[model samples]
Target: MSPTPQAVYLNGEWCTSDSACVSVFDRGYLFGDGVYEVIPAFAGRLFGLDEHMARLSRSLEALGIVPPLKHDDWLAIFERLLASTDAPDAAIYLQVTRGAPAKRDHAWPDASVRPGVMATVSPIGAIDGGARVITLPDERWGRCDIKSINLLPNTMARQQAVEQGCDEAVLVRDGLVMEGAATNLFAVVGGRLLTAPNGPRILPGITRGLLLDLVRRKRLMELDESFISIGALREADEVFLTSSTKDIWPVVEIDGEPVGAGEHAGRAGPITRLLDRHFQALKTRRSDP
Candidate 1:
C-alpha cells in the first residue's frame, strides 16, 4: 500500500506523477499507438542503454512514429530521472506516443503534431523464488516484434496466471511454445539449450540476447534458436525464462506440474544454476570500472 513514485518526465518537463498527463485525444490513449522501452540501472549505471535505444528506434520506425529526442537527449533524461531515485538499482520506463490529433480518426494525424514522450523511474524488486507458470494461448497481435504500448493480451494472460497461483504465463501458439507473458522462454532438452527463434512472434529481449552471448562465449551447452514444441517443453529437463527486469528465472512448475527430471526434478537444474552464475558475473563485470 505504499504510494507510487512522484518523479516523472513528461514531454521535456520534469513533473510529479500526479501532474503528468497526456491529452485525451492522444493516439496512444485512443488506440495504443506508441512504443516503450524499459532500461535497468544498477548503482545509477544504465545497463544495455544503447541496445534498448536501438530497439526503441526500430519500434518507432516500424510504427511510422518519429522519435521525439536524440540519443544524447535520451541519455540526459535518463540521468536526471535516475538521480531522482535513491535506490541502488532501478528501472527506467520511457514511452513515446504519436501525439493527440485534432479529431479521433482511424488515419494518422497531421505531420505538425509532435509525439508525446514520458518517462518514469521505479526501484527494481528482487525475485524471491522460482516461477510457477501456466501455459496459455498466444492471442496477441502479429507484430510482437514492435514494443508497442498495446499489452492487453499480455496483461490478461499474466492476470490469469496470477489468479491460478502462478508466477508467469508461457504462451503457446499452434502447439509451439512462444514465450512467457513478458519474458522469453528457454528449455534444456537432451543436454542442449532450446528457445524460440527471433521473429515477429517474439520480442528479441535484450537479456535474452546477452544470455545467448554468454552461452556462446563459454560454450556451456549446445544452443539452438528454434521453435520448441509444447510437448517438448513439457518433457524438457529444465525450463527458464529471461527478461530485462527478471534476468533469468527457473520454471519449477508449469500448470501445477513439476519441471525437469532425475536428480534435479522439480528443482532448479544444474544448467540453470550455471547460467545464473554467469549472469551474476556479467552483472558484477558491468558494475566494475
Candidate 2:
C-alpha cells in the first residue's frame, strides 16, 4: 500500500507523515505507558470526534498523564491533518504518551514529560458483507476500560483469528462472551439485541453506541447489556460485530456454527439492515455539510 499523504501533528509541529517520529526514550515505547484514540472520519468530516477526544482526555487522567494539548488545539490540529490528507473516509489515530526521558526506571519521571501527540488519516474501504470470528479465552487485564497501549493479548488474539481464516476474534471470559479483540460484539436472539454491559469487561466502543441508538430509534427489541455465552450466540437469531473501522458487520457463522441460519441464513438481518441504512444516511449527511 502506498504511504498515506496525511499530515501529522507531533509535539507542536504539523508536518508530513515522514517527519513524524517519537523519541527512542519515550516511556510509551519502553513501558507502554500511554493511551490513544481512533476517531473515524466520513467523507471529510470527523464523526464523534468530541466523544473520542473526551475519551482520550479521560484516558490521560486515568493514566496520571496530563493532556498534551487543549481540546480546541487538538481539534484544530486534527482538522489540519484531515484537510492535508486525500482520503475520503479515514480513521484519525491520536496517541499521547508520558513523553521521552533519557532513563529507564519503574518510577514516573520527576518532571512534566512533554506529552507526545501525533495523528494521521487513511482510507476506510467498503464494509465487508459479513465476517467470520473465532472465540478466544479472554486474557486481558481487569483494567481494559483504561484503553492503555498494552495490547499484547488483543494483538495475539487478532493474529490468531487471521491465521484461523477469520475476520475477527471474539474474546470470551469464563465461557461468557466478552467482546471482540478490536471491536464490540452484539447478538440478536429471539428477535432481541444483546450485548455485554459497559464495565471492566468491555471497552466502550463508539460504533457500539451508535448501533444501540439506531436500534432504539427503530423501536426494535433490545436487551440491556449483559453477558452472552458462546453457546447462546450459536443459537441466536443473529450475531454481529461493530467498530470504528468496520461499522456493523453481520456474523452469519461463528467458529464453524451458523448463526441465524434458518431464515436469515448468511445475510444481514432486518435490524442489521435498518442500522446499516441509518449509519449510511448519517455518513451521507455529514459528507454533504
Candidate 3:
C-alpha cells in the first residue's frame, strides 16, 4: 500500500488532506449525520467491493439518504483512487453526508440539498498479533449495523483500553460479547468457533464474513454464529478480532488474563492460526466475488 497518501477526494475534487475541508454546517460535522465505508484494495485489486458496497447502500438507505452513485460509478471512483495510490494494500475510506443547509435546523433539509461526498486512501500498515483486549460495555446506539460515522462510544472504549495497556476493546452488551470497538470478534469455545451473528448490535465486518466462509468451506472447525458471554470469551481457548485493515488479530490476553488451554494457553491457539493461514492465502485472490 502507499506509504503516504498524496491526496484525498473531496466533493469530486482531489486535494491534500490539509486543503480538503467540508462546510462547518455539514451534517456529518455538526451531528454525525453520515455513513461511511472502508474498503481495502490488495494487489491493485479492490477487495470485497460487492459486499462493502452492499453494506454502504443499506446504510444510506437506512438513513433515508438517496444513494449518490450507482455501483458502476462507485467502482470507477475506487479504481481511479487505487490507481493514484502507490501501495498495493491501500484502504479506501469514503463517506456521504447530508449537505450543509442554509440554517442549522434539526429537521431534514430541503430536497434541493445535495449530498456531500468525500473519499481518501491510506496504507494498511503492518499489524503485530498477540493483541490484549479488555471487555467493556457497548453503549452505542441501537443501530450499530448502520456503519454511521458516530463512533464516540467505541473511541472512548478503545482509548480506555489503550490507557490500560491493552490493544483493543471488546464491547459487551447485556453481558454478552457484542464485538470489538471497530472489529468483529470470534471465540473458540470447546473447539467450536463462536461469533456474534450480524445484527443491530454488531457491525458486519468484511473480514469477519470472509473468515467465517473460509472456515465453513474448508471445514476447518465447527462454526456457530451466536454470542459467547463475556465470561466465556475471557476463558476461551482462542480469541481473535477481524477488521478490514487489521486482519486476524490473535487475542493472547483478555482483561489481563491469558487465553487458550493446554500447551496453546496464553498464545495464539491452533484453530486461530489455522484460520489465519487460510485467511492469508485467501487474501491472494486478486478479485473477490
Q: Pick the candidate with the highest lDDT.
A: 1
Residue 141 C-alpha lDDT in model 3: 98
> Residue by residue across 101-162, what tens digits does model 2's lDDT show?
77888788865568766777677888756888888899999988788888999999999999
Question: Which structure is stronger by lDDT: 1 or 2?
Answer: 1
Please list all clashing residue pairs in model 1, or write none if there are none. Answer: none
Q: Write the per-residue lDDT of candidate 3 for residues 93-144, one digit (tens) a residue.
A: 9999987898798798987888889988888888866899888988999999
Better of 1 and 3 by lDDT: 1
- Stretches of candidate 3 above 4 Å error? 1-5, 287-289
Better candidate by TM-score, 2 or 3? 3
Q: Identify the runs in model 1 with alpha carbons over 4 angstroms from their true place.
A: 1-5
RMSD of each candidate? 1.1, 1.8, 2.3
Would you give me the overall lDDT of model 1? 0.92
**Candidate 1 lDDT by residue in tens digits, 1-289:** 8586568889878898877778999889999999999999987899888789999999999999988999999999999989999988999999999999899998998789999999999999999889999999999999899999999999999999999999999999999999999999999999999999999999989999989999999898899999999989999999999998898899999888899877788889999999999998897788776
TM-score per prediction, in order, is 0.97, 0.94, 0.95
Say which candidate scores most in TM-score. 1
**Which residue pairs in candidate 3 have backbone atoms (N, alpha carbon, C) closer than 3 angstroms, thus clashing?**
1-87, 1-88, 1-89, 2-87, 237-260
Rank by lDDT, descending?
1, 3, 2
lDDT of each: 0.92, 0.82, 0.88
